[model samples]
Target: MNKLPPEALEHVANYFRTLSEPTRLRVLNVLGTSELSVGEIAQLVDSSVANVSRHLAQMAQHGLVARESRGNSVYYRVADPTVNELCDLVCGSVARRFDQVVSAHAAFVASTAPARRRRAG
Candidate 1:
């Protein structure tokens, strides 16, 4: 990224920005698993067909997803498989942080339990 020119860096930023939306993330998650029609994606994402189609169009433009037309239906899939890798890395980091928080919370409760019991007794 430091090696890239300003214009290329801006494009990279836009690519990440494209994935920042919750709905777009959900759409990509579904595509990572299987190719689906816009309707199918809409159903799984708990959104409307029109809304999902709009998201797909933008994602396709960004080269984040691929679209295929079959008769009256169109299907979408993740164009860059590396996106799953990126998601896995991020999710793993978040999961580790959550585990740390959970462990801390459990330890705090254990430390306070004896104090609470003594007060009651």
Candidate 2:
């Protein structure tokens, strides 16, 4: 891969920052491959319409989402398809780490069980 210049790196960082919010990620997940109005997205994400709108606007500005006006409502969809791929990669990594942690904890508990039984007896 080619190295990015300092300014380009900053832009990349800002783009990642845009996706760093839980609400925005939820909005993307809610959107998936379908275009939905702000109200519909808000209901699906269990957030206030106003709050979802704000997040949608921010995502739109970042070029992460696209919006269209239909009658009185603005509908949104994911603009950068690669965003979903990126999220999937991160989610897989997180799941692996979580499993590793759980396994380690279970092993620790198993190891301590015998000692505890011995002490009690």
Best model per TM-score: 2
User: Model 1: per-residue lDDT, tens digit, 1-121?
Assistant: 7589999998999899888889999998877868999999999999999999999888898999998999999999999999889988988999999999999999999999999999999
- lDDT by residue (60-113, candidate 2, tens digit) is 988999998989888899999999999999999999999999999999999999
**Candidate 2 TM-score, C-alpha based:** 0.95
**Model 2 RMSD, rounded to 1 decimal:** 1.1
Once fitted onto the true fold, the runs of candidate 2 whose alpha carbons sit more than 4 angstroms away are: none
- In model 1, the Cα lDDT at residue 6 comes to 91
Best by lDDT: 2
Worst 10 residues of 1 by lDDT: 26-35
Candidate 2 lDDT score relative to the true structure: 0.94
At residue 14, what lDDT does model 1 achieve? Answer: 87
Q: Native-vs-model 1 lDDT?
A: 0.92
